[model samples]
Target chain A: MSINKDTIVAIFLLLFCGIMINSSFDIEDPGYQGMKASFWPTIVLCLLSVMSLVMLIKSMVSTTDNNLNSENTNSQNIFLKFKNASICFLMFILFLAFLDYLGMLIGGVLFVFGLLTLLGGFEIKKIINHSIISIITIGIMWSIFTFGLKVILPEGEILRIW
Target chain B: MIDVILQAFASIVLDPVTLGLMFVGTLAGILAGAIPGFTIAMGVILTLPFTFGMTAIQGLATMLGVFVGGFSGGLMSCMLTGIPGTPSSVATTFDGFPLVRSGRPGLALGLGLWSSFFGGMISAVILVALAPQLAFLGLEFGPWDYFSLIIFALTITVSLSGGNITKGLIAGLLGLFAATVGEDEINGVARFTFGFDDFKQGFAFLPVLIGLFAFSQLLTDVEDDKRAKSPLMSQSGTVVKVEHRQAILIILKRWVNLFRSSFIGIFTGILPAAGGSISNILAYDQAKKASPNRSNFGKGEYDGVIAPEAANNATAGGALIMMMALGIPGDIVTAVMLGALMIHNIIPGPTFIQDEPLLAYGVFIAFFVAHFFMVGLQAFSLRIFLLVTKIPMYVLASVILAYCAIGVFALHNIVFDIWVMFFFGVIGYFMKKLGFPLAPMILGVVLGKLAELNLARATGISDDMLLFISRPWSLFFLLMAVISVIFPFYQEAKKETLFAKLYVPVSMIVLSLPLFLMGSPVRMIVAVILVLTGAYFLYKRTSSLKIT
Candidate 1:
């Protein structure tokens, strides 16, 4: 039997809440008026646990209505869609990594150019124009926040000199 | 008060920088709001980091401009493309598109803008008068009362959860748990940090917000772009010149619907979690019920456009009342705005009004000024907004992703927050696909800490958890929460087990036993309510079962 998305969510949340509750044990309880540092998390996790269990039961009981969960249509379609979107997602991850090392201004410009290139039908001319626009836009954004507003942005190891 | 208001108004108007920022915010709001997939909350959030440099008045005025302009701008798409620019504009499309198709797009747009302006003005007037009174009432709330009030506020989730009570509850609970990740407010001990220094300070509110709403939407837009080509409007440059005089006369004739819808908007806006999405639909429903030309509502009736547009815009004003007076946000946009205020180290509470009267008055005046700007701009710049709507999804997504990254980075100059945003973005996207509502979860995060802090304080003060129900207001809110949770199910299932019918009320009554043992009148009243409701449910359930 294939696990429906709801069942998966429930199981994941159950495990998450379990971990959360267990971790609460590590904190020193204040024990004042039977309330402590762990009190609220305990209450929240307890409610979450109950609700997650209910969701699991409901998902299990209504397996016939699995079609109601739209994401469960077909594994292949889901994968293809995820794969298509993964290009952008990958660009996002790369952008974050770039921002970490290359600084906000340079990293932002590169991130925009790369994402636009992937999105721009792969025509060199279109990619070049999109990159130009992306650079101008990112430049303006960087100037406004970094220079105009005096907000700090990452300068990268190499770019920190200038 | 009058002098302060005058000074605030003068300061905003005379200062070109502040005025220009407000203008920019309004223009950006109109463009963003006209986009089919963008929400006003996203507009406000995208504008938040921009405000970090300005003073409280300048920043807030700019945000308010966006708030008003965004609400007004949704009708552009609704009229031009049959797409509701924001969730609040969903009802606008019902009659608005038909009007566009009927060749009076100009009239529909004109009516919607005027309606929104009037709605905004009316709510502002009411806010100016009512907020102080509410603030006074807010000052009376103790920890227990505040906790109860939050319970009552959270009942709004029942109405908002898109008919998935269990999922909504789960989402809200998860949010509360997420809020507990940082150091404990009472003991300074970390509960859920899992040994990470980044987790110790907990997830910053802005990062979580940006992730949930803006970044998640970006990812979803990307997915949608991959799945199907987005349908673009046919005539991207078409402009229909509205006969303003005729439209104003038509609006003037429907004064009753205007005022009534605006009032409904304000009332719903005051209810936490029930924002424009609820108010606009309600206003439209009430207009349908009250209008002489009910048949024309969905057939391109001008009153139909007016009802929702007016109501939705009015909600901005109504929501501000709760935010300013009580320190609690009534909806997502206000919630973000609350975060904005908090970022400036201005804590909102009963004393918020007193402590920051000048700024408070400045916000009120700003709302009024924003309406004026929105009206003036939309009148001459409809084509500009139309062009903005035609921006390609991928281009917008890429820009939004970059903004999300850069904006979060600018918040604390920390890279960890970016990761936090990315993580929640994935969660939010999947949650949307799974039909779990995001608003409840957001409300949970925003209110969870407030609820827990107050509940813990109340626990400390009273030395008994059950003593929360000993107060009259506390008991009332708890009882309301119980009813709110059950009422949806009761409506869904007309026939249920008799045992099930008695479960919640019986448990609540039993739970109130400590108060009863303490011989408090509050418990007696609560017990009576539970008994009556329980008996009624039992009677209905048994009769329905027998009939079936």
Candidate 2:
């Protein structure tokens, strides 16, 4: 028997609520206060758990409607969509990692260049075009934020030599 | 007061620095709004940190430029490619695209621009006049009343969540939960920090907002297989020459629609969470009902273009009114603006008007200047608008990703917020995939602190939980919340006879089980209501099913 995606989501949220409730207990209460630090979180966790249970049951019961189930399954290539989003997500994680060591200017340029190549592929002309645009964008952004705005961005130890 | 207003206006107009910044800001806003997949809200969020370095009026002046320009810029893509640049301009595509297809692209573009300007002017006038009165009302609200007002605001989720109350409520509750992660405002004790030092300051709403909206959108764009489609500029179409004066006069002749739609835009804008999306659709509906050439509407009637365009642009003024007068944001953009203002140490609301009347009035004057600048800028920059659509998706996506990273980093020179943004981006993506709406979640984040603070204040005063319902204003709001939540269910039930049948017995069992276990009076009352309504619906459904 195939488990419905809706049921899977409901189960995931149910588990998240369980964790949230457990975490809520660790929140130190303000002694005899009107509402404790954990008060709203606990209420929300209870509501969320109840809602997740209903959602799970609803998905289970609605499985008899083959039309709805088929419609949900046949909407798009979920695997392909997940793959593409995962690539971008990985690229973003890389960008975040780069920002600390490379500084905003260098890290931003590398991220833009890398992402453009990832999306458009490694055509020489396009890569060159992407590189030029990335440089120009980073140069302007660095100057504006660093000099014009006087907001200090992370200049990393390596880039501090410059 | 008049002298102060004049002085504020003079300071803005005479100072070349402010004037130039406003022009640049408007141009940027137009570019931001004109780009497909970029929203005015996103534009406002991206622009917030830049305003940190500028004066209050100057920063606000620049943002106003973005606000006005973004609304007007959406018309470009709608006419040219039949794709709305922003959601607010979705209706503009129906008639504007048809007009473009008929080779009167110039007329559609011209009429839309002029309508936007006039609609913006009308809303600005009303905002100037009505906001002071509304602010006076806001000033009278005590803690109990303020809590009630917030409840009314939260119910906006019912209208916005695309007819899914349970999902909307869950999203809202999730947002409220996220808001509690930081130090407790009352006790200074951290909640839900999960032992991370970074979580102590909590997730900054700005970074979180950019993540949910801009970053998540970028992620979705990347997931599209055909993300590298040919630029819109490659399409060849004739733009018939339009007489600007003649077109303006023709749009002006529909004075009833202009005023009516603008009023709808303003009123809807003032309502918390009801932004241009609702206003445009409502205005279009009203115009269709009143139009003599109603049948011609969807078939390229100019009135169709005028109504939604006018209404949506007018929403800018209407939204600003709430932000300026009551200190409550009517929508996401204003919420961001409130954040920016707080960053500059300028508090909005009734006290804003009383203390910084000149600055408050300066903001009003800034809108007028921004609209005027929008007209001049949009008129001569038609070629640039055409070029904006031609930007490649990958390049755009990459630039935005970098911008998001840089913008969040610039906020406090911290990278933790960027990580928080990334975390929320993943959550937002999954939520969207699961058919949950993000608007309610964002609204929850914006209003959560307010709601918590006010509820605490009110509860402290009353010393009884039941006092919330005993207060007349609070009771009224709770009643409104009930109606807002149940009315949609009621409407859905009326449509689905089978659902009404199944829902009743199921809800009765569900409610009764909890009531039996808990033995709470409130649970019993709720269960009783469910049984009665469920029984009535079940009976009606059975009768209908039998007849069938």
Candidate 3:
């Protein structure tokens, strides 16, 4: 009775496709020349639904044939394994969320330093190394974008300076 | 023509300032190409303003240097970082990174560089000899034919799917769906937006590309602490040399692959709107199909690296030919170049060569010479690039991610693109975990807009759905698409099934029909030869069956 990862993913994708297909109907046809805007999206969603259904059936059949509990067991371990990556991804999200406040100069440097520490370790030597690398890398990047390319990096609302 | 070419060559070579500018442009292109989100089109656009002050020939030559160099530059990042620097080099990363992982980084780099050089050379020669003829061929493709061609290109998803065909199809469908999320280009209807203002613009191709390939790749690289602290390449301490001689020999040995891939690049490049992205993947698929060691393709096969690198570089020459001969920009980079040409009061078309013989020939020379500069400059630049391997994974990942964010932001100065990159990165990571191939999805995203645009155009012209298969060019592409779809299955069956046995003969017979209908003597003769070959094969198969 245990559901495998593939089966779960297939179900999720199938539901997504159903939702998309439902949304496609709301698009105004306009009765303009050529196919409606919904036409291509609907065709793609239908194909996606079919493929997801196939995946679901295939995974279910295989699971039944093998009757393997390993996948179910391994599913729990997968969450534990993704701990480092999850933390890193969260840090990235936080960096973006605070980007307008801190600006790319500060935000970028802090994000790099934070990621480096998260990934490399919390040792004093590693922190020093990470800080230097962060400042140098972000400084070079900011200079290039602002001066070389003449692209305006976000200056932050708090630290606004012309 | 000879006089024009000689004059053009003399003008470019004799001027040190022009040559220096070209050298500098090539270097800039390489740097731009090595960055994950910094595309060749961006590099050319940056160089456009600089070119305004120079003479037309000087300006064109400088941009051409950037164009050619940018194509070759992508392989460095692809091989070293496992993230393609540009979309065209996406396929190169398949084998190049794996080869680097397998401790053959030198060979992989060398193979990529030399293949790019040779491919560029071949395309340049073709551009010189057959620009007019090839540009005319490009003019023949209608909306139906273009749509069919995209369908044929989409068949690569099957080949790229690896072992899981269902996941691959789903992934591709998801990509196509992603492209349809914004307002419809043709009718301006909001699609799948659900009141989100950001969704109205749709997902840009670059952010999606960087997220799926670069960001997701970085996440995987730093999955654990041990892997995170380590260098990108395990053998980082060793002095990695670009084994030029050995790579050249290998490329020479695989001359057929080289020629075939280059020709694929050139042919795809000639078609307006079709560019290196399609050609590289097409060449890689074709290489996989034709290779004796096909199983080794994704696992660091040199042929895989060679095919895509070669195709992408050759694409520049093909694109330039279209721009110079027909006033039609083949791809975005050429579109930028077309803008540059227009700024200089130069208009390229059917009578352009006659009117501006020296300038036209100068462009050809610039393109041709740019390859030589690319080869020479890559040798020096690659050494500097290899230093990236020495950086710890954590530092490299963090820096690259920041750059990705900045690059995405700079693309349109939008924070939404950064979110798109992050979202796709998460999705890409899971897809990799679930064993869904990423290449097919990337291909889907890349071609989705073009396919929909063409389909809309085709349908808008006439409600006759039959025109898709009735038009000569459209029928040819449709037939090719059918063959391409069956090819993977045919490869698996390998003459065991009746369908497999008849695949070659049937393909030849059907393919010849379109050529025969093309109404040119050369095409008719080629069609006749194809029919004869097909008949001979059929006769031999029947005879063998009777004996059995």
Candidate 4:
């Protein structure tokens, strides 16, 4: 009784669309309109819902006919398989969250260096290499945006000096 | 006209300062185009401020150089990395990156570069010779026609879906849903915001684009620890060179495809709001349908690279024709150029060519000359671009992600865009893993607003839905849409199938209805010919079937 991955995805999408369609009703309709604001979104969501249902049914049929547990192979240790991507994504979120506080220059350098160590290795030599590459790369980018294009990069809130 | 063109050419080439500025602008445009999340429109907008101090010809030339270079610059990153540097280059990755993966980066780069050059040259000729006439075609499209045309464009999702039609449809529907999240343009009502103010803006197109194509791609590249530490490409030992001679011969052999794709680009460009993004994909779809080796398209076919690369570059010339002759901006880049012209106290309209002959012709010459410069400059810069493959995947991914952040932030100077990028990236990554094709989704997002807007406008104009079928242009697009939707099925059908046998003649007969309705004598004659040819084919097929 293993649920196929695609079946789960389809069910999730159907639920999301159901939620969206429900919310479409809450949209404030400014009575003066030829078509309501929710008209297009509702149509799109209905189509999505139909397609998701189709996907769900198709996946279920295929799974039944084949008597296959495709999900079992990959679903056992999903976290282990996606650990690197998960960490990278977490780092990305953290970097963006504290971007204003750390500024692009310092923030960018740290982000790059951390990613490099996480992705490459944490050996002392690799750390030094990562440090140099991060600083140089971030420095050049910062200089180009700040100087050449005249685009003002975000100076950190705390590090802001007149 | 010849004298005016010569005068324009002399002004651009003879002046060192203008030439220097154009050169610089082209280089800058290439840099902008080669970076993921950076757009050609942004490059032109940045160059716009610098143009204010220069003479009208110099200013236009500089911007035109950027415009031309940016279109071609996208191919470098597209082939080297799976990520498209610009939205227009998205289709290039279909075959270009796969070709790179197959260890022919040189051939792919050369093909892309040369195709762009030829496509640009073809469109430039048309722009100069028939700007007024072609610009007039743009005026013929009503909201009904535009909506129908988008419907036709949306049918490409069938072709993009590969083997999973249901997943593709769901992905496309999701994209359309995403577009509908923001405030309604005509009426200022938010539909899917859910009371969150940040969601009102919905997803900015660029952030979504970068997130889906660039950020998600980077995550995939670094998903495996061992793979992340290695260089981007496997061909680490060999020095990659652009196989210019080989590429030229290959392009020359496929002259019909090159010409057809360029024409497609030019036509799409002439239509307002339809830009390089649409043109490239349209060209790729047409190429795939026409190619004998259609199955090889997403698997690294040369036709795939040639069609998109050529079409996107040609689109610039098509856009310029509308801007110069009709006072209409064909796309965002041309819209910015139009603003630059207005800044110079020049207004473009129906009589713009008559009023500002020198400046108008200057634009034509500059556009032509910029292609030459793009070819020369790209040849040199491509060597440097190839070095990107040598960087470790992790390093490249991290750096590109940072650039993606910066580029997205720079677009609006807002932190919200960065968040949008991250959110979409996660969704895109999941979609990829689930085997839901991303191309259809991207197409849906790009065309969704235009489709909705036109649909609304069409309905508002008249309560009678019969107008959608009665209008010649609308009917024409509807026919094309029907054909486009069934094309994949037709292509996949066995040769013995009745559907396969009837597909060509039926398509011809059905498509000719619009031509006949057009009322022009030439079009009527063409329609008559089509009917005769289609009838002849139908008769032959029926006769053969009876004998069998």
Candidate 5:
């Protein structure tokens, strides 16, 4: 279901109010009373809520450019939104999973190659060329980070086996 | 003064390590900046783990170089195509693409390069002269001021929300709400831990930022790509066409708007919290407002191209003031520099200036050298940056996801951050889908800890909440914040309500109560001047809006 701005904003306002109400219960001990942390947070929340209320009124009264008119939905698809984002998410998981198993050099190489080829749709021949370039560049990065700069990387499966 | 800067310059130039660091920093920064989606600060933060191995100077020098380059490299995107490489270059795209369309990519590039360099130089001169005085003044700011200032910053986000201001505030407040999770900033009590030790550190800032900026952006990009009707968009391809003479004189002519915007950029940059993104927007807006010819704007006016281009790039010199003088960071990039310094156990406040004078000077010298390298390198390698812009949407989308995960894992080697990231990604997606601005949420998260900590310190007692308002600087910001909040409502209501029309003068007097309570007479004078200026904007916007 396409959510309205009012609905989303309403949820936000509800959450802020809830948080402020809950935080108000926080009364610190007497000695620490002067610098009581909750005090400032409450102020921030209170101001936020007022600003939010003002926003809600504005949105409610605003014009109809939303999904009630199918024209808006025609231009924006929810699934397409998830698809591009998922590629990135999936690649990240791959980067992490291999960071230790492949060693920094090999792992970075595969990750970039796999990312480029899989996501980029390069043919096998182009993959090899791109992989070679990526690996070489990563080699420089590895030396720069580990050798010269001293950043540590996971040794992963390669180091364990060797 | 010349001798001082000269000595500082010579000291920095003589250091082999500093020289090397500057080169590496500038080059790496240019690469990071040229590519869309990679921020200079994000680049530094991503590579921070590597900096753990280097000295403080080396680490900071490299980050600064990258920051400068990232801001400068954006011009390529603006010039070659209408799209901005970075958010800071959105204004550049206004005229930059027009210039390209007019067959003057070289002029766009040249103007971009020199004006940015000139802007940085002018800002440096200002910073070197006035930073100490400014820093001393900033030191006087108390807790209430922070409380007010952050609120004021948060309020500005509402203006950016675009039509549905409430949704924006809601997202922002939700972000503030998110900050309360994990461990309490004070008393170490868990507010929203829900019972896991995982919540103790709160959500990792960088990971959350990655999710919000990079992850959510990926989702939006994917949606954008999916909806693309062009068969050419999906076909993975390489196309590079550069046809234009380098117009150096065109750059020289635009120096008028370029310098005007640059000065505005420098001043805004000197203030804490304003970063490249805001500097560019404000500079573009200022240029548009100040131009005698407003209709030319957004249609590819030359001033539109240079205003943001110069300001966004110039702000780097301005941010250095806060970094070198006060320990306070103006933005995330400087914050990363602070972290680098911390890794070296090098404290950054006023003492940093006296103790590491040459090191600080070296950073300054590096900025000069780095800008020169960035412009020269980009002029030749324009193809590389443009080629990056050509990546098929599906493939680019995947890379965005990959980086988000990498960034999530980078923070603490914890899978927990991945969850926070995904959660924020979902949150950010909805925020965007619902018309809320994500910048406020991120800013809210960034300032949350500082405001809490400062307020606690100011109170000096756990029980006395009111102590925050007792101080001068704190009260001043608080008053300013009140004005910021009420002014919008007043402005909006003036046209629609007879009550507002009848009572605005009296209500304004009441609204300006915080000003009257000022501790410094100087602050009072500034406040009055500000009120008058604000009134002008308020009256103008409201009247125009009502008329429409």
Candidate 6:
């Protein structure tokens, strides 16, 4: 598996952090006896991590089977790999931050446009078309959610007056 | 039984909402399915969360529409572009695409449209009439039967997990093992929990699905197009006319092949793990098997188009029967349907049939009517969609990613889930790269929680663990599970060597201790089987250094 060990580590770290944080949630309360509500999933994370750990170890200890065939050997460009994944991570973090702050529609438009322009480097005309289309799409989406399904979506300062 | 039919007809024919949604879903699904790189499986997974807010009938009706439309939509690409829009339509592309290339596009579309619709309607009629009988069969299942079912479903991964048996087995085992990570439902003992609360709730099935299909694809797209992915398929030409008499003659000539494929589709649909893609492949192969013109099977034979189109479409109807009435899903689409049902707090099974016959029957109506609308509407729009098939997939890909983002954000009005979606997406992308079968993994996780829940409830184990598999129902599933867990490696050995493989049973005699300790006679059977199978595979792996 070509999955970066860091990403897997990051996932486990996040799970570990969640376990720590949630465990702090009313630690004093006597939970489900013989098994707290958190008990099963906690077990799951450890097991998953251990499995990940085994995977990591196997990945590390295994000899390059690629020795048998050049095509099977995967030698990647470090910079390109780093650049793509970093950009992806950045896009996600930014989407979260923007949506949390500006609301889904406006934030979503910016994210879509930004991801396209920054990651893709599309022509300016394409960028504009993408932006306009995204805004309209999100707008229809917002209406559908709020009016049709009545799902309470994030209303930015623009729509709070309503 | 007659009342059930009447109820289905009455609810579907008369209910405006059910009919309308089914129509809408069918049209939209066809559009989605006909496009390049857009799969119905992903469509089903993506929409599952949205269904959380809907009532059971409405939600199920929507998915049913999507299923019908998605399967039929693949024909659009086949007739227009020569590329099958979905994998199931691969055979259709052989014949339908050739006709388009021959400037007989309309003929191709006419054939594909009629074939898909006929197969769908016929199978759906069978499903509507026979689903209750099938559901009763499912109701007879015990834990072991379900366990065996999961086993059979999981085994299919070996066939599909790319060439290496070890790789497939490892991947399948990883999925099964991943399933065990969550809480032990039988004892409330967190078997693998390292204290994470989310871990206790177990992994979110939808997010994992997104990771495997959406994220994985997105990552691959990013790399392939230098990351500027478009989800659309480019195309050309419009439908050509075939004489009315010729069309009828064509259908009748291929009637035997068509019926066989349809039945294959329905049976496959009923089997968990084997979905439309498998049925399509199996049906296409069967058509060739039965055809005197087998050599022409791949070179634009009508049977090539009819076989898969019929089977893939038929499977959709069959899947619904199990999902709506039996609670268990036969494949991913129905698996998503299962998630949708939980949203409405409606448990599917005999109880659902007894309590909500109207809802169940109404869904049948939705299936029939949606096919009707798609058939009627596409009859006119077929030419337009056919001519415009040249749009690139990269542009389409961007739009779907955009919608995926929007979908995640719309649910819970929270960005957290969006991140979750992205997180899973990236994971899915990487997992695919590594050669793991994420579908089985997702299945394992989805059923893992429930399996654990049922196991716990059945055991009352703290009081007495031995009683867990004592019931006939539990015992049956347990025996099946035992056979299921070990059979793959055994099959691998038997296929590889005939005589020396007899020693495979030697280890079975030795590793009988651990399962015996698990206490349940059913599980002990499984344990002994696992030990022997694992040993045999370990031997095979050491001996065969060649990965192929």
Residue B238 of model 4 has an lDDT of 33
Q: Write the per-residue lDDT of candidate 6 for residues B448-481, one digit (tens) a residue.
A: 5655454434333244545445544444444544
Each predicted model: what fraction of the native A–B Cα contacts (within 8 Å) does it retain? Answer: 0.64, 0.65, 0.73, 0.64, 0.38, 0.12
Quote the lDDT for B209 in model 3.
71
Second chain TM-score for model 1: 0.89
TM-score of 5: 0.77
True contacts kept of 5: 0.38
Q: What does candidate 4's lDDT look like per residue over B1-548, in tens digits?
A: 78987888889988898889889888777766876645787677556645645788898999998988898888888787677878889999999999999989899989999999999999999998888675456468788887776666555554534657677778778878888887888688887887789888778666776677667877887887777887655542233578989999999999999999999999888765567888999999999999999889999999999999999999998888877865655665775676667657786665778778888888888898888889889866665546655677788778867877876776567889889989999999989988887766766776677678878898788877898899988998888777866777888999777898899998999889999999999889999999999999988886677554
Off by over 4 Å in 2: A30-34, A64-77, B232-242, B490-548
Better of 1 and 4 by lDDT: 1
TM agreement with the true structure for every prediction: 0.91, 0.88, 0.75, 0.75, 0.77, 0.78
lDDT of 2 by residue, B1-548 (tens): 89998989987898999999999889888877777778888788788878878998998899989998999888887787777888888888888899878877778887888899999999989988988877886786667767767766777664555745777777877887788788978778888788888888977888888888778877877667576544534552333454478669889899999999999999888887788878888888998999999888877888998999999989999999988887888888888888888777776766688788888888899999999899888754556766666677767777878888877888888999889889998999888877778887887777777778887787677678775665545555565565556646655676556655665455554444434433557657876887777677667667767553
Writing each residue's lDDT as its tens digit, candidate 5 over A106-154 gives: 7766766675565555677767766775567566666655566454545
Complex DockQ per candidate:
0.61, 0.57, 0.50, 0.49, 0.33, 0.26
Q: Model 5 residue B30 lDDT?
A: 65
- The local distance difference test score of model 1 is 0.81
List the pairs of residues colliding in candidate 1.
Answer: none
Question: How far in Å is the alpha carbon of B260 misplaced in model 2?
Answer: 1.1
Residue A93 local lDDT, model 3: 98
lDDT of 6 at B362: 75
lDDT of 3 by residue, A122-159 (tens): 99998999999999999998887777657777888757
Better of 1 and 5 by TM-score: 1
Best by TM-score: 1
Better of 3 and 6 by DockQ: 3
For candidate 4, the docking band is acceptable
Tell me which residue pairs clash in candidate 2.
Answer: none
